[model samples]
Target: MNVTVKYFASLREKLNLSEEQLTLPQGVNQGDQLKAFLCLRGPQWQKVFQETGPLQIAINQERASWQDIFSDNDEIALFPPVTGG
Candidate 1:
């Protein structure tokens, strides 16, 4: 399936990227699976994704979790946790 992926805040800084258009291979249908697919890009990608604890996700602009499933033409946003005092 094809989808758009976005990175925000520190994740963008670390990855030096803001957005990507991807046509995923078969069997990648969930948030966690998508993340694992991205992590395969390289060590920097792995570090930015795997080392970050429970990064936030949004599916088509609505908040979602790693377990959430997504589909073609979907917009997936990933970001570090937000903390406000």
Candidate 2:
């Protein structure tokens, strides 16, 4: 299935990308599974996705959890935790 992945805030800078379309492999249907797939890209990705603290995820603009499943054409947004003074 095809999904659109978005990066925001520091994650955008770290990944050097704002968004991209992904063709997910079979059995990779959940948020956590997607993360694991990206981390396999290399150390840079692993650092931002694996070593970093909790990230916020949204599926189709609604808040989503690691267990959330994905569907074709879904939009997944990943961002760092928000903080306010």
In terms of TM-score, how similar is model 2 to the real structure?
Answer: 0.94
For each candidate, the alpha-carbon lDDT, in order, equals 0.91, 0.92
**By TM-score, how accurate is candidate 1?**
0.93
Worst 10 residues of 2 by lDDT: 47-56
Q: For residues 1-85, what per-residue lDDT tens digits would candidate 2 score against the true structure?
A: 9999999998998889999999999999999999999998999999988656899899999998989998999999999888899
lDDT of 2 at 74: 98
User: Judged by lDDT against the true structure, how good is candidate 1?
Assistant: 0.91
Best by TM-score: 2
Clashes of 1: 0
Q: Alpha-carbon error at 57 in model 2, in Å?
A: 0.6
- C-alpha positional error of residue 1 in candidate 1 after TM-score superposition, expressed in Å: 0.6
